[model samples]
Target: GKTQNIYALNYNDKDNDIKISLGLLDTKHNWSGWISPVNGKGTKSDTPNKRWNFNIQKSVDLTNKDEMVFGLQYTKDSMHKTEHNLVNGELNKQSKGNTRSYGLYIQNDHKFDNKWSILSGIRYDNWKVYDSWMQLDKDKSKTIYYPARSDSSFSPKIALQYKIDDESNLFTSWGKAFAAPTLQKMFSGSASSASYTEANPNLNPQTVKTVEIGYKKKFGESTILGVTYYHNDINDLLYTRKTGLGKITYTVNGSTYTKDKQRVENAGTATTNGIELDLNHKINDQWSMFANYMYQQSKIDKCSTNGAAEGKIMTYVPKHVFNLGVDYSAGKWNSELVGSYQSKMYAQDNNSDTAKGVYTAYDPYFVVDFNLTYSMDKNSSISFAVNNLFDKEYYSYNLCEGRNYMLTVDYNF
Candidate 1:
């Protein structure tokens, strides 16, 4: 016999454009099972991660058919956690991380006619972090810890949209995005893997430039179509290297000196392009169907470190994805069926030595989900849904758990 546990979150938001939100997140996890060579006792782990956020958005009208909008957002986040193994009573760690960010954005919408309109917007963000982690080599013993460092960055986004007619619209836009490296990567001050000899405290943020074009069309009163094409170029990816740790001896209390050489660099660049399409049709008042397709490709344009990913495809990003679903509603009964598929994707960055081979492509797989509902009255209904009907075997984003089915029931009173 075995026991399992769960953790959850609940949030509440109030107000209009300028909003306030609060939430609580907690975990109470325990597992117990009986097996051959291991202790049948259970394991327990308790942790909590929480955050409170506030956002503000407002729009000003410049003309009868034109308006400009602006927004500001802020968040405060914190986490506390620990890990332990029940069989051997191995104590792990209890640490936390926190961050805050603020942003300003503006946009304008103009209408030229019933079938023609244009929209554009620009945004800026300033982000900051506290309690960042870093690894270091102190004394002869290696230790990992957080370093005191405050970093900030400015990023921008721009977009434009044009309407072709009442039934169709075409649009395109370009923007820039950025992400700062984790604190552990910088200050942990120690290296466990052979890829990095030492942590780089001066690591820069990763940057990306994205361009996209899209169109949306409506046919008759029961069908709609949407298509989009996007491309992205990224730069300044962090690269790690190995450095020799030479033999040395020294006295600790009075005179102890050790010597080591660390290797570090920031050499990473890449480009990705993709296309997306979606279609929805209402065959009648009792039946409807929806379909979606996505195709993407990513390649390494530059490499600064010795890794399988250099000059090869980015890890985990698949080249194709698709989904289809149908829904039926008649009188007091309703039902739905949905399916999704994804093409094979690589599991490693380098094209070499992998337990399953360098180009370990996962098999193409699909999942079917179903749902049913019954109306208790004109104002109330009850419903049940089962996700992953066939329980297909697949993984998204490499390290995540594979597929599973879920049964859900909802009631309205």
Candidate 2:
């Protein structure tokens, strides 16, 4: 176990949001504006971020019952990450890097009567990376420096919706999304000391193109059900690859000065397709139920990862997930129960010799949660909730925190 006081965590965040809507005029003209500013800081262990953003829009009536909306938005952000570690009984990790970005966006939404609608938007983003103060090897005490780099691109999206009736609707969307490498990725040079793994500095931004179609139907008086099918093609999927695990090598300006650098490549490609279903049903005046199900698959198209061949499933992506829950209320009492399940998934490809057998695959698991509430009055209540009711072993986003329980009490007047 690590020592106490060996690490201290500090954090600070401040944010402000403002909005204005002018709705007094006629239907021919209306305007709205929104603005936000955010700032954050942390100790030597986390990243520091700050940003400012604003959006304004105006709607104009074009003829009998149809309207055209025009909108513009701007955002700017700056981020910094400090790298620190202890080495040779001394604090020698004083690396720092930063990134800055600016974006411009425009969007429009139009409605025809009340049966059909369309939405479209486009955005341009530009960003730069600054890297410095990186060490390659402590044994030889070598360091490497990279020049600042910058890139920019455009992303767009379009969606359409049609009302099938008063209780049903159909919609579809095709969109493109982009992400830029963070300052940590750009400055954490590909050098591993005696303790840490090599960090890739040449990492590139990942991108994905997605298409989805869905339909929603409302049945009975208080029940709703919907289903969606989605497919995505991704490029430049970034991942850390462990090269030959031999003695490390370190260099400076093309010369082999130290022997502590591990070779690595930070790029790959992936494709994912999935189907999702959601339902909400009211059993009576005092009881309701909800269910959600998802089936998805991820495949690595290109990579040299362990057991990752041309069309194998990616690591850590479960194929099936289901969640069911119920809520009840009667007079002054209310309660809820929810259960979730996940299907088994492979930790590595089947062909690999070291691969765990099918039976040893990650096991399917279930968890149940419960909540109860008592109304002290019309304007007050006390509630208690317990998560992981059975304390079943499970993982969320690759992390396990064990069973958790909490209690909350509130009063209003």
* Residue range with the least summed lDDT across 10 consecutive positions in model 2: 23-32
Candidate 2 per-residue lDDT over residues 1-413, each given as its tens digit: 11112111222222312232221111221111112222221112334444444455555556555455554444444433333331223333334555566666656677775998887888777776665445533332655665787777788988999999999999999988878765445554433222234556666677789999999999979999999999998887765443344555542222344442343344467889999999999999999999999999888887654334558775557889999999999999999999989876654343232222223246577889899999989878888988888877554323454578788887653
RMSD each, Å: 7.8, 12.0
lDDT of each: 0.61, 0.63
lDDT of 1 by residue, 1-413 (tens): 22333332323233333333334332233222222233354333343444555666666778999988787766655544333445676543334455566667777888877655666666665555567442122232333445544545455555666667778888888877767665345432321211224445566667788999999999999999999999999888654433233433422223335544343446689899999999999999999999999999888778766444556766557788999999999989989998888776654456332333112235556778788888878757777767667655554423323444444454433
Off by over 4 Å in 2: 1-89, 92-94, 137-141, 182-196, 242-266, 304-308, 329-335, 345-363, 371-384, 395-399, 407-413
Residue 398 local lDDT, model 1: 32
* Worst ten in a row by lDDT for model 1: 187-196
Give lDDT for model 1: 0.61
What TM-score goes with each of the models?
0.70, 0.67
Question: lDDT score, residue 299, model 2?
Answer: 86
In model 2, pairs of residues that clash are 248-259, 248-260, 249-260, 249-261
Show model 1 residue runs off by greater than 4 Å. Answer: 1-20, 28-48, 60-62, 81-95, 112-116, 132-145, 179-205, 238-267, 330-334, 351-363, 373-382, 395-413
